[model samples]
Target: MGTLDSDDLKSGVDLKSQTDDVSLVDERTAEQKKIDDWLPITSSRNAKWYYAAFHNVTAMVGAGVLSLPYAMSNLGWGPGVVILILSWVITLYTLWQMVEMHEMVPGKRFDRYHELGQEAFGEKLGLYIVVPQQLICEVGVDIVYMVTGGASLKKIHDIIWDGAPKIKTTYFIMIFASVHFVLSHLPNFNSISGVSLAAAVMSLTYSTIAWSASIHKGMQQNVEYGYKGKDRAETTFNFFTALGDVAFAYAGHNVVLEIQATIPSTPEKPSKGPMWRGVLVAYIVVALCYFPVALIGYYMFGNEVDDNILISLNKPKWLIAAANFFVVIHVIGSYQIYAMPVFDMIETLLVKKLKFKPTFALRFISRNIYVAFTMFVAITFPFFGGLLGFFGGFAFAPTTYFLPCIMWLAIYKPKRFSLSWCTNWICIFLGLCLMILSPIGGLQNIIKKAKDYKFYN
Candidate 1:
């Protein structure tokens, strides 16, 4: 982030500054025997810097690596590269809109998404655009991670048991839920950030080293094993499917905002510029990481990428070890990042809003209940293909392509309204097209596979 001018220094107010201003503007609400338990927490300080970096990495790492092969197959390697770059550019532009939306508000950055939705687009529209979209998108991400973690679990079972396990996916979900159970309750910001940092580094290192190896091998194959094409299908990308992956890939921006809000300083001139500096850094990182894999995955595997990138790589015995290590790391981090909010929301509803007393027993029960609920998605047992495609194809597009623009327009007042706003509307149109196509293709693919249970069964 960049340093602000003297004027920015004057206006930039953080949580403490907001509270101080509140003391002057409204006295009673500010001084009512207050203690900050952080259950009903304000955004933390210094959060934006780390959050921006973490989310940029997280957004890039999650969907692209594993899902690259599958998405590229439909669109072709060249088109996939084109779309990913295009998406990255569009994503950065829209994210700029989002940041402006936040900066316009001047405080609490995101006090209430719905309220911002109202402010940005007016009451009825914000409710329609911002509220439903965020709720669905956030929950949808939860489901994607659950399913991703479950896929890794099923893969583990195959490795350990030398065969798929009975009630395989259900068992996998349970295992996934068990681990996330610990992470969601954890409130330590630094610990989470540390893990996020390490995971980001580890993922980058492993992916780069492994992908480079794959590229080297690919070069060898091109020269030595020329034209002995493996059996691969011609993938026709349903735009909705591609868009779904796009949305998921560019997510964590919301989480980035949350992290920024939590930073312990006022919204004053930070050590850096919030707009260009923070976002520019994020944009550079994502493009470098995701584009290569999307290209390589398509180049190597054709259409068999499945849900994870490693599947497409199908590396020799050596790289598989590193791949396994990262898959575990991905699942662990994904679970923590996605599920913690669900726990927080549930906590707010139960203990705060419901006026129920917080009890250790209740906490334990709530954790167990949430863990159990994760089962609904995975209970079909040992099935990854159907669920992954269905959600990736269905929910991911709306979450990605459509939601950000909607949220931006709905939440923040714009600088230039008339002609400039049309870009958002244009994005909405494209997003809708994407949402419809991706999910339809994914579900169709899943349905066909399920119907052909003849061989696998």
Candidate 2:
């Protein structure tokens, strides 16, 4: 979405420094060569930094943003705000670290996270670990997208056609997936940056709507405050569980590297300037989008907040329709951004391992089929909120928190017990702690909720 043994390896290998060697240029295998032509154009160097910033912003601020109020409620305002700020600073640092590490290996470009892992760990171990978690986080997020998008569509359906038959969420999921299938034909990750920018705008628009609604409702209702020490306040387990949601809220690290690689860098002029600028701009935008909705939603609804803040509102039909429309559009674009990595991994595997030539028809068919598979799974298990916890705690936390720290340790081998070393381990320890506890909390919540759960309900 986002580690390892030591001692059996070398230190400071300097992947980029080795680029001066004449033999390594364009060292593409036949398989790589074939796939290169088949896949869509992916270089983003010609792209403006604003578009890159938009892509990063949208990728980080999807369904996870909706859960922030609930996360805030669990930890209380003080703790929640503190955690959000900390998560932002730490994740931004790690993201830049990743970008910096990416720059280190100019000799062989790492367009993917697993490739970085392999260089750091010295085997396919990186591939094995990074690939699955990345897929799980991305696909899991996509499933949540469908789930939320279906719910939005169903709401509109009920409003516009008051006497119509009730359709299952599964059908809505299929409809969303069908649309995704059509959009999936657009080649590669770089081409979609503009779409991602538009999606980011939608996200900001809906988030603003949610925030405004929370404020108006908070003003109108004489709701009681549960600052702390209340019966509905979070238990220790709930706090950890909330951390999972918050962790995933910052889970763009998994795709950041992939997005970076798409930026076209010439030998004479590297793309680092635009990349760093874009990343910083993106985080600033993320903070702007996340904090207000969370603070206001928790302020409005307290511990009773819905997993999605939109569903918690009681607004006019027109306003609801507009908000939901934005959400559906945002998720549609978000799904493609996340799914691109998975498609790349599968296509690469097919070409390299099975000796399958990467043809246009094959790429088109395989990717659409993969989209269908994701949709099928979402339809089958529409446990939207529970899936968020599972994916966040199990996949996003490690990818965002644990492994990045481990990778930092491996790459730099910072002075033992120094501040840098201590900080990294602290992050890793926190990551492991959340990884274990949050899932247990998440599962407990899932099991409790499952008692009344029904398929396509």
Candidate 3:
């Protein structure tokens, strides 16, 4: 009787301990669920695939497109076309890889880029590698857009009233950023779909106007298809910088996984199918926007082309003004698309790492601060071309060109001699070169510009 009672008491204690553990886990998980529900990236899951399409269109085709012609001037005819096409195909492949990887594990979704990174690289290492590059890419793009938006606003003012009192570009950048102060508060990706779609339409609109206007202006007198650099060393540096510009133009990959996370997924259908479809649509639109603006703009202006093609086309005052207006609208949407991820990152750090409550006050203060920071940077530097090249190679190249390939190889691990392996290795090699070389030229160009530039002018 004594032995039986002892055995029963031990069994009861074990059961009670297990039950308490279960209860604690359940409570912790429920709290996590609430936090996820409030964060912008995870707050919604009903977005359609076309939302991916326009969101991507808005993200990829921003101020960078305007610089394509200038990139061609530095790269010249043969190399420029080859590089542009290669980037399109390579980025598309990597983007498809990301979409596939989004749900590769089955029954779970990698809702953010870093989550996918953690799956490939260990948890801490993954955050270290991906988060910094992703932040630089997103935040860098937002800052560039601020400069682009402000410049476009200034263009409109110039065209509308050629001799009117000039407002400082600083004020224009500030005005552009003010719009985000309100739009940034929207809870999630799906909520901004309408704005994204409008931005998409504006991208196509301005691109068409850009190319058509270039044709309307006809070929310039003594247009030199020759390289702009006066010496071999200068030519080499400009070539590298141009690569960064092209890399910047194709920078949709940084947010591709996040875009995929918005789509509804199921075992029966999978999110990749719809997401891939949207990617195809987005790529087609990209090709349309990129090739014409590049080829035609370069053909018309050649070595003398302005860093921004719109600045080169000054005829037909109303039409040029309209294009500038479209640019402002497109970048307005672009800024939000990129800023969404940064917002999520900030909010995540506050709530999860810092233990701040998820509240309106926290969100309001944090997001506003971010906007102000970017605005201040934009006003201070305002070197649109240099900024694009530097950020594009430093951050965009890895995220768009090679990071996905690295992750795919790491996770999937195709046979060493296989076609998949070779293709990925080629992408990795090219991306690594772009990452290494492009920034050197970009820094040189920024230095050159800074020598003659005035701050906040």
Candidate 4:
């Protein structure tokens, strides 16, 4: 009888222990669920494929397009066209790779770029490899957008008022950044879809105005098709910098997985289908916006064009002003598109890593600080062309051009010397070259600009 009683007691204790373990797991999971639910990237998963379209368009086609003509001037006719077309093809293939990889692991989705990195590179190494590069790319873009938005606004003020007392570009940047202070708090990607769509439309509109206006102005007198640099060494440096500019223009890839995370997915029909559809449409728009602006703007203005095409076309006063305004609206949306992921990373760190409560106050304070930081950088060093090249080559090259390819080779391990393998390798090699060379040129350009530039002017 005593043995029977002891057995019952032991069984009861074992059951109780199992129950406690299950309860603990449930609690932890529930807490995680709350955090995921609160995060901007994972808060919603109902975005349509077309959301991918405009969000991508908004993300991809920003102020970088304005500089394509400038890039062409350094690259010249043959190299410029070849590089431009090749970039379009390579980036498009890489983008498709990302979309396909989104749901590659059955029943699991790589929701963020870093999450995908973690899958390919292991937990610690993945974060180290992807997070810094991704942060630099996204944050660098926001800074550039600050300069673009402010510059466009200043352009408008200058054109309309025409020699009225000049407002410092610093004030204009602050004014541009103020919009983000409000928009940044919107919580997630899906929430900002409307803003992104508007920005995408504005991108197309302004791009059209840019090329059309160049045509209207006709070729400038004494336009030189030769490189703008004064000597061979300068010309070579400019060529490197121009490569970065093209890299910068195709940077939508940085945000592809995050955008896909917003789309609804199921076992039977994955998110990639709709996401690809949207990407196709977006790419079409990108081609339309990019090719004409680069080719026509260069054809007409040649080496003398400003970094931003809109700045060069000052004639038809009202149209140029309108184009500048469109640029402002487009960049406002682009800023949020880029800023959303950074917010996600910050919130994730605070809530998950630091154990801070995911409260409105935390989000408000953190996001405001980010906006202010980017605004300060933009105001201090508003060297638009130089900034593009530096960020483009240093950060954008890896993420947009070849990071996806590297991730693919690591994950898929395609057949040796097969088409996929060769293609990815080519991309990886070219991307590495861009990463190494362009920053040198960009830094030189920045130093050259700083010689004449007064801080905060």
Candidate 5:
């Protein structure tokens, strides 16, 4: 009436288009689902004890096995084990903060990490910091595993040949890694969940079995790799510094969240409460799964601990072979599963932004590029030397230490900062302090790696 004014017309336009914007978002999401690569680390069924436990081993155990020796070598047993335990505690604190964030925005499907970041820290912050952090963590993890696997190959080669391989071993890792992806269950996840679980079980079983056997065989005592001792002060400094890598081994809380989101609960309604349930159980299970192996491995190779402990063992030929088998399987599964985001970053730039979906041939070419990039970055670097420091300092650095208290402040705004709140507060503060310390280990390890390459060039 009264010839509806400009304000009225503007309001009408706004009301009319709100639905359109939402619909547009839905359309875009649906389109995204069509192309493979939507999930990173979720299993199809809400698996039970096996799923929760296996994921824990797969996610947390890799770095621990490889890096415990090196971590303990500098820090020695007392400092190393204590730091490893403390790092787990810190990670658990950050992990709860992660869960707290999801609670804040329950209605929206806060599936992707960036979405969680968007809800917690606003859109721009999520885009700039959280997402980038996730990408960096992922890339860093890629570097760690690829390097470790390559080094494992080198180790096996050297052992078999009675020294380092005559062959250009990097080429084998590249080819083997590439073919593994091709042969693995394709991009869809349900197919691979069983294998992932199986790999985790086999690796865990083989690790424990081999280690227990070795222990009985009197292989558990500390053995020197014969390197000159570090100065007392320098070694002490390095030991405290190496906590970062141990923290890194304990930093797979992200994967746990992804897992928690997937596994169905036994409770009729699937409440978030601890029925000793999926996500909650996952947190504890992963911790227990990791602790013993790390402790035992450190015990086996004190001060000489390098990275992967199994390879450190002076054992029967078959035991080393079995351990190597499990490690290789573990690495391959991890690579295939985690390789998505790397591809996503590339595709987002090319297909979505550039508006051209690559042909199958083009996609294959991209995969090759990824493999080449992975091998070079890993092998040319520490071959897993700096892995513990990198993840501990970077991925876990932000997520575990700083995020919880800030997230609580942002979302819950608790007044007295209840016991629940205080726990998170300490975690956040401790995480920040530890994160500050996390990189020193990495820097020294990088230097160590650079200085010695295969005892040759």
Candidate 6:
């Protein structure tokens, strides 16, 4: 044979070695080489940043937002602004840090917080701790949405019918449950973004109505329009209640990774840039809508503000009816978005643990069953205030504030007492403090109002 070049000899040896190494790789590892094998290439992956941003906005702006003014009323305007701004900053920072952790996996994407937790800590901790927290928070939120949506629908029904036989809120909730069960059948998170966009608009619509109504009410002769909290001792106790409210308002962190995974990824431009762009734009929109509604609402209602400022509005029946309709629509959409993760987790477990293939019939039946279960819970507890306090105190502090920091430290293992280390520790400390205090405050507040609690009243 003719003398071969040295380059040919080297290439031949490399090819042989690569072929030999292939057998050592596991089937899962081999399948991961083709991203399509793990994740479906669907329209859900084709979302642009603004579309993604709308989902984030819808996720963040929900029933909890109506509580903001009440939160601010407990704390004065100055302190309210400080707490809101600080919460926003800390959440944003932790969110960014989460994205950073997400990128460390090179070609892989984390589609859930539990995945991130598993990678950072261990599979047991991830599956048991993080997963349960997500389920409780998300399921709890869906229950709240149902309760609030029923109230809104009832308000609209009353306004239109004028002395129509007063149907129990349970009837309205059952009606909404039927509608939401249908909507929940939408295949994936990306597909739900369309509904989320409408929901975002609905939230903005009602928020604008509430804000204008508040301004109009405050400007009327004889109405006071400034810092309104009195009863120093009462305010002090309620201030912790406010912390949980604001925390619940920002409780979209559990699904951030799920939303992030919906954006299409390319080798040149990873999901990181798009994720950050979408989140930043969404938060800016959230702040604009949230601050005005909360501030103006508090200014108008003062200490008399209801947990839901919409109820406290002195607007005409038609206007309040319109706002309530919008609230119902927004929550209707939001309930599905939040509930999707729980559905996904359960479906995945069934397929993986029980070897149940993900057929359309299975998916349809399972999701419908899940929706019915949540409806049952909502009907049973009609304890809106208590649920909010319990879920917000128990879940929001840890998921939104505490865990993100610790996860970052666990992943990066930064130098001892370095800026990263110190910052994360401080976050952990603050989160722990909130976790301990908020629940106590919220439980007490709930107890104080327990006598008024009724099931589907």
Give candidate 4's TM-score.
0.93
Q: Any runs in candidate 5 off by more than 4 Å, and if so which?
A: 1-53, 76-78, 160-165, 180-185, 219-229, 260-276, 279-289, 304-307, 348-351, 358-365, 382-384, 387-392, 452-457
- The regions of model 1 sitting more than 4 angstroms off are 1-36, 40-43, 46-48, 121-128, 153-169, 188-191, 219-240, 265-267, 270-278, 303-307, 358-364, 381-395, 407-419, 452-457
lDDT of 4 by residue, 1-457 (tens): 3455888899999999989977985776775888898999999999998899999999999878988998999999999999999999999999999999999998689999999999999999999999998998888889989998998899899989997999998999999998998998998999999999999999999999999999999999989899878899999999998988888899898889999999999889899999999999999999999999999999999999888787788789999999999999999999999998999999999998899999999999999999999999899888855866776686789998899999999999999999999999999998899899899889889889988888886
Question: How well does candidate 1 match the true structure in TM-score terms?
Answer: 0.77
TM per prediction: 0.77, 0.89, 0.93, 0.93, 0.78, 0.89
Q: Is candidate 1 or candidate 5 better by lDDT?
A: 5
Better of 1 and 2 by TM-score: 2
The C-alpha local distance difference test score for the whole of candidate 2 amounts to: 0.78
**Model 2: worst 10 consecutive residues (lDDT sum):** 1-10
Q: How close is candidate 6 to the true structure, as a TM-score?
A: 0.89
Error of 5 at 265 (Å): 10
* Candidate 6 C-alpha lDDT tens digits along 1-457: 8887999999999998877766654554664343223222222576778866887888888867877888887777788888888888888888888766766786577767899999888989777779878887898899888888887888899888998889998988898898987898887877777789999899888888888888876743454534443566666677777877888888888888888777788669988788889899888878877889888887777767888887787368889898889988899888977887887777766765787765778878888888898889878776755666766677788888879889888888999989989988988887887777677767877787776776556
Q: Which ten residues in a row have the lowest lDDT in candidate 6?
A: 34-43
Tens digit per residue, CA lDDT, model 2, 1-457: 2132353233324444465353344464442555665554332345666766887888888866877987887788788888888888878877877877776765456778888898888777887888778877888888888787887888778766778999988888888888888888777776787679788999888888888878876643655445343344337667767887888788788788778777767666566667889999999889888999888888888878877887888576677778888888888888888888888788877876787877778788898888888888788778756756866687888888878889889988999999989988988887787788777667767776778878766
Model 2 steric clash pairs? 1-133, 1-134, 2-399, 16-104, 16-105, 16-106, 44-262, 45-264
Ranking by lDDT: 4, 3, 6, 2, 5, 1
Clashes of 4: 0
Better of 2 and 4 by lDDT: 4
Ten contiguous residues minimizing lDDT sum, candidate 3: 384-393
The lDDT values for all models are 0.57, 0.78, 0.90, 0.91, 0.59, 0.79
Cα RMSD of all models vs. native, in order, equals 7.1, 8.5, 6.1, 6.1, 7.4, 3.5
Q: What TM-score does candidate 5 reach?
A: 0.78
- For 1-457, candidate 1 gives per-residue lDDT tens digits of 9988987776765656977877764664343222223432341344656555664465446634556555666565556667787777776776665555554645445534454566756779766765455555555555656666666666655655554436546566667767766665565343466666655665576566545755765742332211222423313434445545555677654444444444454566632255346567766766666767666655665544445666545556346546655666665665555554555556557776686665556666775677666655545423444445465544445445556677666544345656557787777887676666666656756666677554322
Worst 10-residue lDDT window, candidate 4: 384-393
Q: Which residue pairs in candidate 6 have backbone atoms (N, alpha carbon, C) closer than 3 angstroms, thus clashing?
A: none
